[model samples]
Target: MTSSTSSSSAPEPIWAVLGASGFIGSSLQAVLARAGITVRFVKAPRLSARSTDPAGILAEAAELHDIRQDLAGDLAGADVVINAAGLATPAGADSPELRGANALLPVVVADAADAAGARRFLHLSSAAVQGHRPVLDESTDVEPFSAYSRSKALGEAALGARKAGACPVTCLRATSVQGAARQTTASLVRIASTPLASVAGRGDSPSAVSSVDALCAFVLAAGRYPGEVPAVILQPWEGATVASVLLAAGGRKPLRLPGWLCRAGLKAGYALSGLLGERLHGTLRRVEMMWFGQRQEPGWAEATANVPEPRVEQVLRAARQQR
Candidate 1:
């Protein structure tokens, strides 16, 4: 369950992961390497998280001016191509860069991968596609309420629309991802480092989370997945809430506001942002996600891939220690 090693005798896969330096992409490379898979990176200049690349087991790396360029010849040997490049932050949604990464990027990669004769394509999407829901699953209709979520939904749809004859594609819709390098974890580290911090709302709203370990496991499963393509909303079987995670991260109770008051305040804040021609950079959307997040079951991946119970608390503990 911890490692994504396939039991089948199938030969190791040749993987070409786009955006190899971001939180998910970076972690994915390490996981695949640990599994002894042959993996390479296609580092888009616009996509890398770090200004300088980190040393790793990338067999080869490329800087492409356009993701849609002819890659079939160079990538002919790749078994699968993973579009792990994405905009993870709220501010990224409002920025002009989103159209390329969150909307146009995946489709371009899918088309290029298909042309490159990759057998399969796996895309990394977010559970934010659900916006604010009570219970979530793969079949739940996504109702994105914010720019970030909307972009993710659009990316899914774009990838979903590929020509039927192309490479088989699967989307891994994950919950709030927590890892050492992830933006969310970094934000929590800053909050925990602060001597005084206050959490908003009742601090008990249920929010699904995916540890980097779990998310990476799901991705690896998708590469070797033999069953029909399924909508996999990856999360622990047990549920956790925003307050619990915050407390676990910082080890201090955050200032709480009434649930109703929090919602009202968010609405007011949104209105003021419009009036002042200001942008909160999806802060209100994030608050809404925390206040009204959904609970989901792993379902398909659990039954087929045997994904593990994500150690959510462990992920938080690691972040705190790093702080």
Candidate 2:
């Protein structure tokens, strides 16, 4: 499933992408190449791996404003800087490393983008910042609960606090993104393939998902947009409902979970969360999302109205194939 989004009207911007080897980041690079855009890849050192200079890496990251590694020289030629770096596994164990990657890294990167005279700095944030909130948008108040959500929210807030610059910053709060590279998407599809999986409210709720391709399309258009985009943009929804997506991936509809049963499960899930913390809470958030699904602002899609329409069905097909 590919998108042909070429436009001769607006000049394409040179891209500098951090974390270019990660799933989303790598996928984005493919999309950019397909569209004939010039890009610079700046891969960050892996913090999760055993490293000899872990302290040096941590110090160079923006633990504090004074110590942020100056990256302007690396980003000098780029017109747009896309920050695809950060800890992707939000459910992992908490530590200073996690917080620094998710929370402090953006501050350093944004400062560098400004110094480099880039036109924009696009930060990849997560919808997890909203936690299990029923509805969400760029303007909605944050309700971060888990260690990961809190860290992501903190990054957004830290970036938000900076004074406006010619090189503006935009944080993209991506939703439940899926692709062939993500094991999590494969796992979800595998679960839905089984008879044990069930959905809430007859599975009519929005899936709150956008394919990696669609997300890349959004970034492609938004990055070079001739006008102003919001400081924070929710990943644009592409009209795939939970039931439909599951059916696409599994070849059968997920069993319907009744409202009463759903409510009881959530109650029990929350009660158990006190002891289990992230492990139990992660499951609870998934349940809440399946039932309520979060609402988002439509302005993002409207702003990029001419961008190629997303093929979410193909995304599910790929997930099914991978699973």
Q: Judged by TM-score, which candidate is best?
A: 2
Q: Among all windows of ten consecutive residues in candidate 2, which has the lowest summed lDDT?
A: 45-54
Candidate 2, residue 58: lDDT: 36
For model 1, state the Cα shift of residue 154 in Å: 1.6
Error of 1 at 178 (Å): 1.5
Clashing pairs in 1: 198-255, 199-254, 199-255
Q: Model 2, residue 161: displacement in angstroms?
A: 1.1
Residue-level lDDT for 1 in candidate 2: 15
Query: Candidate 1's residue-wise lDDT over 1-323, tens digit each?
Result: 02234555877778888777788888888888887787777764343211111111011112343445654554567888887888776544344466456756666676677778888888888777776666667764778656677777766765554454468777778777788766677786577545534445566666675588877877887787676666334444435677677677777766665677776877898888666543663666655554555566557766775566657778887888877
lDDT of 2 by residue, 1-323 (tens): 12233556776557899888788988998888787776688755333212113243334443444333447777887888999999876566666677677766776788888888998899999989887677767774798867778778877877786656678899988888888778767876787789856777778777786688888988888887878878988887778787877787677888888878988988887887767766677667766765656666676756658344776768878878866
Q: Which residue ranges in model 1 land beyond 4 Å of their true spot?
A: 1-11, 45-69, 93-96, 192-204, 231-238, 274-278
